[model samples]
Target chain A: MSETRMPALSRRRVIVTAAQLGAASVASAFLARHAAATPESAKEWLGKLAKGEAKAGKVSIKAPEIAENGNNVPVTVAVESPMTAADYVKAVHVVADGNPNPGVASFFLTPACGKAEVQTRIRMATTQNIVAVAEMGDGSLWTATRQVKVTIGGCGG
Target chain B: MAADVKPRIKAPATAKKGETFEIKTLVTHEMESGQRKDADGKTIPRKIINAFHCKLNGREVFSAKIEPAVAANPYLSFFVRAEESGTYEFTWVDDDGSLYKAEHKIAVS
Candidate 1:
């Protein structure tokens, strides 16, 4: 039985790769068209935001490099701030590059929070980069990101 | 009540006045991606929790708008400073307009 399963598993892998390649090709074409209209590509939205157009520095995001479950992956963002009326963090946005929809969560924070920190779990259709963007009271933006690898066969996919 | 929805809160039930504390929360939800089909080959209507808000002493401290792409059983954690002892209220609103709420109190020593 083990010998018989080995060949089947290899065949399944080949099929999966072919399917993924096909999907990637389709996605590339779609992105090309979409990018023409939007200033930022879906996958590079964070990078665009980080190129001095938005304030940079003092934000950190923690996420797993590999997620065993794609349906629910944990994410956390923390910012260094006094959380005072004058210097508090304003908002934190979570974006998932390569998902059907990249924008995942946007958190609005007030000085009453006393600290700028948020943790949440988000879904990923496939392996992708998750970016966290934080807006500060001084009209500045900071960001951090990590890549998450998701297993493909689970969740009835 | 939806069989799939589950809610939990993690926070210290007691804290000293003027102390800062962290709060963690999670809810079990489908958070349908709106891009998939059900078993009947029909598009499953998107039902996701779009907003979460926490209020202490009738004052807002934290709020968030979640998108459909958020993972199932969403977990959110944040920090708050306890200036005075009062009830901390947490509410989660779904895209379908369903609301889930939880409350925690802090006793200042």
Candidate 2:
């Protein structure tokens, strides 16, 4: 399987290169069209209140590097929290950068939840970064991101 | 209408009085996004579990707003601090105002 895929990737690269040289090709056209399909930035889903303030820490995102099918990409997010009354995660948000809608899922939590972790499957239209944001009770935000490559578009289309 | 949408939940049976434990869930549903057509060539009305909430006794601890982009069999894993001995009630709300519920009991030792 590995040997068969190597040549296919290089061939795709060659075709992309040819298309990049002002040659009208179907592959480039599809690329351009599908690329535009992803309009909303992941930041837009993150909310304006957190701009330039969130840092990457105490968060772990689990997602596949290459998803053969984009229909059901299993993703998990875990954050470091004791789930104590005084120090806990208030909410968690998941976003996909390349999907038509960046917002994937939102989870709200309270101190009664002892741990800060969420797992779910999401639809991905293309290869893109999946982001997980955790908002702490102390008004601090943390994030983690992972890239997943999709071979087939998911979303039942 | 989606019927008998089975829900699976795993939570701690016992925990320290002030300790936190994990809750894992998998709710099976087709999550028909209303974009697809049926064999009769008519669009299938959207039916999905749009919201989920976990409560300890009468206190809400965790909740989620699910989206159409979420995949089928919506799997979720989360954590909650076990403050006292009580039953953790989980409810999944379907788009059509139906609810699926599951519960687990934990004893704070």
Candidate 3:
């Protein structure tokens, strides 16, 4: 009985050690904002800034369905705003659901741009939804989202 | 002085009148979030590029108010409809009172 218990105890120890190692590696990547790193973070950021009601319209986000590389993924966001002095897009926010940092970029625009559009490249940690929130000058909000599957090198080769 | 931060900007060399062109930009920054710790476990003060401004022909083309959530080495691409030939000026302001600037010329044909 004693001999059988020893083997079971050793196996359990090995499993615990391996689990700790994996967590340590991922922890290093997100040294700061450890608590904020989660799928809920993406929406929390939007809620903090936009608050209250947010509708999906006018905001269009363009991103690749399958990204060859997790790093430097190009994203474009466009809003159908007249971009006139009387009415225009005030700001736009980009969020990636699966990255260590969910909020990616925020763009501020003026009427002189002649169009309410922004394009930027971002990093993706894994397969997740990319959301965009557009704020119109009149205090209304619009949003759009797209899913992207990131493939690591060699695996897809 | 330039070693503090460098601004990289890409603008079209030439474009047809009324053509909407894209401008890509990036700045070298660590984007320290203050929540980080040093080797000694000391808290590092948060410093980031809080503002980005772009102007074409003395007109404000695109501008952004960067928040702390933005990733490091902020990269942004925006568009402006070409009305005339002029230079596009970019300015980035850091939280530590550091200012990085760059300019690109665009010829409107």
Candidate 4:
């Protein structure tokens, strides 16, 4: 009985090693492909903005701790400013870190708003951080972010 | 307005000078998440309204960035203090860089 158990244990070990190697190869290939594509896409989107690029700060993003429905999630962004013509929030950009298209939305504001807050609802593909970047009239950037746990997959990614 | 555009906004038609009021807005859009598949199994391209901005008397007071995770027909409500009698402008920008603007004038006495 002991001799028979030895053979079975050895066979299991071999199988496990084979599976681990196969998984590692697959992961490496995926990483290589993603590495080749990500930077180009990021550059394309960032270049389209007026400032050519945005730094993180100046904007605040609000989202729930947990979302029951991934299809519809509520999000809000507020920027601190005087709302005066001389110095006001020029625009705000929302980006979803794990979403297929990271560049989410851009809002352009003027001095007539009298406040610096906006609220809306959006869809999240998975659990990830939502980032908000605000561009002010003085050509400076500010940012705020929130991490939301999405229970059900909405984007189907 | 584009044939594909649906815009909706709600704010006080009138308010007193130096008073605060709430404004609400919603736009009808598909807000494709780019991760979904149609019945045919093709990936849906991500398209969403990326930003919303509001102006009072041609001055901006509030703005936000939108994302694909935002639910369809995005709803936004916020407050603004009316400084003088003038028009409040609301603009929603889409991912394609199109702008949808609406205006409401307030009378201050």
Query: In terms of lDDT, which candidate is strongest?
Result: 2
Please write out the lDDT profile of model 2 over residues B28-99, one tens digit for every residue: 888876645678878788888899998888889889989777988888888776678989888999998989
Could you give the CAPRI-style class of model 3? Answer: acceptable
Lowest lDDT block of 10, candidate 3 chain A: A29-38
lDDT of 1 by residue, A16-121 (tens): 9899999999999666422222214553655543334454468887888888887778788899999999899988877877676667788999998888988887
DockQ for the candidate 4 complex?
0.45
Candidate 3 residue pairs in clash (backbone atoms < 3 Å): none
Instruction: Give me the displacement of residue A149 in model 3, in angstroms.
Output: 1.7
The window of 10 residues in a row where model 4 chain A has the poorest summed lDDT is: A31-40
Q: Which stretches of candidate 3 lie over 4 Å from their true place?
A: A1-36, A152-157, B1-5, B13-19, B28-50, B56-59, B67-74, B83-87, B105-109
Q: After superposition, how far is residue A81 of candidate 4 from its true place, in Å?
A: 1.5
Score chain A of each prediction against the true chain A by TM-score and list the results.
0.67, 0.75, 0.75, 0.70
For model 3, how many clashes? 0
TM-score: which is higher, 2 or 3? 2
Instruction: Arrange candidates, best lDDT first.
Output: 2, 1, 3, 4
Candidate order by decreasing DockQ: 2, 1, 4, 3
- Can you tell me which runs of candidate 1 are displaced by over 4 Å? A1-39, A43-52, A153-157, B1-6
Extract clashing residue pairs from model 2: A112-B81, A113-B80, A113-B81, A114-B80, A114-B81, A115-B79
In model 4, the runs with Cα more than 4 Å from the true position are: A1-58, B1-6, B45-67, B78-105
